[model samples]
Target: MTRFPLLAGAALLALATSASATSFVATTDTLGGLTANASESTSDISSSFDDDKIVRAARDDAASFVASNGAIRGAQLEAALRHIRQQAPQVQADDQQLARAILAL
Candidate 1:
């Protein structure tokens, strides 16, 4: 009974070590300069968004603003400004200036 437990523990340790040693591989085959399938496209887009979270967030906010404002010029500007601020809080002065410009238009 004790030997059975020892063997099980050894097997578990080996499994863990092997799993840790395994490497992940990523490859792509481009056909006419485009990705092969929708999965690849989604993966690529997701990776890009992950890298540029702030930019993506800003763009999303801008789109939301446009959507909520009923295509009105003033609402469009406010939305854009709000989005920029939300996405890039480090640029307060720039956000204010952009908000003014958008409101004016």
Candidate 2:
């Protein structure tokens, strides 16, 4: 009976090894063919933000507004939003969004 189990186990092991050999080589071949593009690039996300005159203009006001916990709105902040739109009409953010950005700073 012990001999029968040993033979069965050996047969299973041999079958497993043979099946794994084909799949293992196949997977390795596929992996060797895979590669990343050499021209892939990355950039700083903050560089895309509109932090020029608009963000700078709202800096002082933002500190106060942030300190007030969103309760206070400053005149300079409004002016900054208007200035941003005029200076760069392509800007698509709304008034509250612009103010929220300042509050973050």
Candidate 3:
């Protein structure tokens, strides 16, 4: 009946909204962790860590953060890009790799 259709539509909408909101939170957390790790790497580099080691560490941290949080989507990727630009300007290699991975997602 018409009531069935309306109920189904409402359920679908609710489910979609819930999924999107969860995705946003997960992506935000992942990106925030990446930004923090990048800042830490930058500090290590400034403190005389090898550039190659810093990049490697950052890449590993980013990968781990994404893996533990969830898969990134288009919107999440965009959020990460904006976050990187604002949060960690000095980040070069790690941020670049993270951006590429997010875009790939």
Candidate 4:
């Protein structure tokens, strides 16, 4: 019957009612309202560790940390963690994962 087709069409329309999210844009005014975050440690551990273009110190630190089988935590390992946090602030992980990512690079 015609009623069945109308019901099916109504159901399809109801299923297609997903709305798009478009309000996440940060306008200039919104950006200006935010304060500068200076509490975070700004020291770059690899600043002195780099030479030319190759990041050998990070690799060495990661390699040494890996050589310890993750049982030993040292200044080199902490340097790797600081390097990871400085480069990728969004990364939320424990020491092992960050070390693995550093060595994997």
Candidate 5:
């Protein structure tokens, strides 16, 4: 009878719904583990690179130079570089990262 088919379809739909809910719970647990792992690694990296005193001083000096003159050029460029080197002697003129960091300021 048509009623029998309707009842079978309703039962199949309920089973499918319950199966999907179980799969979703499993997927959510997996995602939670991944999120925890990522958070731990992110904290480790942040603590490792948390600014050094020398780098901080150099950035401050660069900021001051920019504030005072509006733009660095010619002898001013040399002076800014010299000031940074004086504060942190390890920084070379051609050190790309330092240059980029200072310029970003």
Candidate 6:
């Protein structure tokens, strides 16, 4: 019985090793024998977003969420504020301010 379990474990280990050996490697166009020119374009990225617009959007979304849910607290509040920070790092508002805004509704 103990020997049977050991044999089964060895068989599974062998099968896993063999399966891993045949596993496919994922490749993209860059890795598939194609050369792509890498260029950094600063204009389009910065020009597309206006600072005021981003701040306004964040505030509006927060207000709407607070209104719908009545309030943001605990993990939900932390996640929402984190999202706002990630979306607009340059925005002047801090987590405390955002939390107050959410609760003010």
- Which candidate has the highest TM-score of all? 3
- Report the number of the highest-lDDT candidate: 2
Cα deviation at 36, candidate 4, in Å, is 33
Reference-based lDDT, each prediction: 0.46, 0.61, 0.56, 0.54, 0.54, 0.49
> Candidate 4 regions off by >4 Å?
1-55
Per-candidate TM-score against the hidden true structure: 0.24, 0.38, 0.43, 0.39, 0.40, 0.28
Query: How many pairs of residues collide in each model?
Result: 0, 0, 0, 0, 0, 0
Residue pairs clashing in model 3 are none
Q: List residue ranges in candidate 2 displaced over 4 A.
A: 1-54, 66-70, 103-105
Worst 10 residues of 5 by lDDT: 90-99
- In candidate 1, what residue range of length 10 has the lowest lDDT sum? 23-32
Q: Return whichever of 1 and 4 wins on TM-score.
A: 4
Ordered list by TM-score, greatest first: 3, 5, 4, 2, 6, 1
The reply for model 5, stretches above 4 Å from the true place, is 48-105
Candidate with more favorable, higher TM-score: 2 or 4? 4
On lDDT, the stronger of 2 and 4 is 2
In candidate 1, which residue pairs clash? none
**What is candidate 3's lDDT per residue for 32-83, written digit by digit as tens?**
9988886665554444323333233344445545665534334444455455
What are the C-alpha RMSDs, in order, of all predicted structures?
14.9, 11.7, 14.5, 10.0, 11.2, 13.7
Range of the 10 consecutive residues with the lowest summed lDDT in candidate 4: 35-44
Q: Please, what are the lDDT tens digits per residue for candidate 5 over residues 1-105? A: 999999999999999999999999999999998767655543433343346443444555555455656353344345545555565554333433333455454
Better of 2 and 3 by lDDT: 2
Instruction: Indicate the worst ten consecutive residues by lDDT in candidate 2.
Output: 37-46
Give the per-residue lDDT of model 1 (tens digit) for 43-71: 43334334443434344434444456533
